[model samples]
Target: MNKFVDYFKIGPVFTYFIRVFRKPDPNAPTSQNLRMMHGINRISIVMFLFCLIVMIVRACTR
Candidate 1:
């Protein structure tokens, strides 16, 4: 459990997930923003799904 939490870097990962689920703040710096750029939401969604799948697999294997 500690290893998995460390692997995900929980703080930042949770922040990013929350930002992606909520509307992005317009005043935030462009570089730090989580909103999709160039119509690439699909890519972000896929990556998120992949991460979830990896976590699920690790849990099951353990």
Candidate 2:
């Protein structure tokens, strides 16, 4: 049971997930391409999470 519980623990991936939504560095150099890329990434991340929640809800309802 303990091992099963440990298997679901949040790890380094959680840090990366948080990093994605955090404020960007003020001093970093900016570019049109880089900004567009990050914007797309943020949108995809939100969409992916929305789909994940939908799937989980459907699974639980069944």
Candidate 3:
């Protein structure tokens, strides 16, 4: 379906999951890198919570 294709085409979710599971880059040795890492961590947490809320709402509505 077009919706499924579109979902996978914008690969942010997949990339986020990969980043969540992958080890932190040992070569990162700067304050900017640390800040970026924190940002990514926060984004991932928010995305996860949003997904959880959506699923709960859908289930309740059904």
Candidate 4:
């Protein structure tokens, strides 16, 4: 007799998104190049998610 099934699991993509949005460590060394790279990555990730949502909505409407 199971009370609840373990159907929900946080995948790697979700974890990556969380990591990307999380605040940077105060003690960690900072580099301009690294910051710019992460900024670009964040922008790309946002664009990809927007496109994915749009595709899904279009599919569902049809």
| Predicted structure with the largest TM-score when compared to the true one | 4
lDDT of each: 0.68, 0.86, 0.79, 0.84
TM-score of each: 0.38, 0.69, 0.50, 0.73
- Model 2 per-residue lDDT tens digits across residues 1-62: 99998998888777867776778788989799978887888898899999999999999999
Residue range 5-50, candidate 1, lDDT tens digits: 7896768866655555665467866562333462366477778789
* Sort order, lDDT high to low: 2, 4, 3, 1
Tens digits of lDDT, candidate 3, 1-62: 98988877858866866676666688966588777886788787879889999999999999
Supply candidate 1's per-residue lDDT for 28: 67
Clashes of 4: 0
Model 3 residue-pair collision total: 0
Considering only N, C-alpha and C atoms within 3 Å, which residue pairs clash in candidate 4?
none
Error of 2 at 49 (Å): 0.4
Q: What is the C-alpha RMSD of each candidate to the true structure, in Å?
A: 7.3, 5.1, 5.3, 5.1
